[model samples]
Target: MTMDGGRALVLGGGGVAGIAWEAGLVAGLAGRGVDLAAADVFVGTSAGSVVGAFLAHGGDLEQAIEIMSARPDGDPAARPPKPDMDLVMTAFALMYDTTLEPREARARIGRMARETPTDGRGAALEEIGRRLPSPKWPDRHLLVTGVDADDGSFVVWDRDGDASLEAAVRASCSVPCVFPTVEIGGRHYMDGGVHSMTNADLVEGASTVVVLEPLAHFTPRDRLERELKTLGDARTVVVGPDQAAIDAFGVDVLSMRLWGPGFRAGLAQAPAVAAQVQEVWAGA
Candidate 1:
């Protein structure tokens, strides 16, 4: 992605701080000449709480509480630290549940996507997918899936050509799906060509765009290489696990702290990670 006067829209707000806060940070930086814009896509009551907190407090704790209190029967304990908000809380919570209710989560995501707005800037775009195809198929979903094995097997999905799918995946996976029309830290960073398209469209744009394994679906090593090769006309960066997988594909790769155990940790690390990516892109 080009790093000049771009935006970094974030989506989803149920589990972690959500994309809104990330968008706010980028916007804040952009306002000061950072060249970034951030947004959050809210999917439910929980997500509503996060978006409400950010909108009410401007990322300030005191303001967030004041806004949250306006909601009837709101619980203070549900609130995160001023910096620890994100959309992946639902995913993490689902992980802990013995039921492993992907279907329920899917339904909730559908509802949340429907409740959000389909147009406008920043948080508004999270609502774009009010009616998405079945998540089970690449044709129906925004991202594609691929699987491979070394000593073990894994899945991978790339956010290379389609930004909307990247946004959807970022929202669905609770990772911050940043964009190029946004800015952060006075530097400009963009999600390349994939910033405007959805993950489903992204799958169609690249070779081996999505990877599915026995238990999970995401970007795997071989798939990353294929995507990079397919994206010869543009610069690209792959985030998440399978660093070695990127190497396996002989693709230029930089690691960022966009995934891991929880939202708090990821939130704490995202700014720095984003900065690093920005720096690399600037130099390139």
Candidate 2:
């Protein structure tokens, strides 16, 4: 498959695992001399924004891989305290009513959120933003995902708004209990994954959709393969984690499980994804 062509890259948001796999996939394509910037369209959700935004800024594949694989999670002592069941339950309660349990949850989490250092997502976006001509993509070259705080609706940010690089990434990666919602202008925003997962039709005019999923490679996931078949008129490619890498990181919660697992396994998963993409681009 030709790496450089009229191709549309679809990025999924699965936290660090997604970032790691997609970063490696980009590196693999670059290793074969592909210019990611030349690709016609790019779409990213949640953590996928980390890499997609980087490309929109004219950075190379290695740059994306480095940023995604970087150990930005930091030392445990220096980072924010882990969220407990109380924090999660409180956040859930607050999602519905802001004046009751939700308000209490917000108050509790707000203090912790302010205290805990950023989850490294802001730093990654800022690094790429430095290379960008502007925060908004000149056109729709880089489309990021976000959810409306008021109605819980899905919104795709095409690097068009006045939101800063860090702000956009934070909105996309704002996992409920893990990272607190960010305020942009005056609106409260959280992670986009809540609404955009497997919703590829959200992107219009995509000639082909390339989904990079970082999860178990089992029959249950095969459903995703079938679901994508009808996503759009565009050709579709679904790449799952190498079956061997499933248990590598172990099933766990949001923090280390998201970012840490892919640091090593992602490097290995990249080449395999490279091979899979050959068919994806064969008709691109």
User: Which candidate ranks first by TM-score, i.e. highest?
Assistant: 2
Kindly list the per-residue Cα lDDT of model 1 for residues 1-284, writing each as its tens digit.
Answer: 22232212212232222222332333333334433212111111112223322332234422332333243323322221222123323422432344645445333433333333323223322322221222222321112221111111112232333333323332333222221122222322222111111222222222211111110122224433543464443433333312322222122111111112222222333454466445434433
Residue-level lDDT of model 2, residues 108-162, one tens digit each, is 4444444544554344334433433355554546767776554455666655667
TM-score of each: 0.28, 0.70
The best candidate by lDDT is 2
Q: Which segments of model 1 are wrong by more than 4 Å?
A: 1-34, 38-225, 241-267
**What lDDT does the true structure give each of the candidates?**
0.27, 0.57
Residue 116 in candidate 1, Cα distance off native in Å? 22
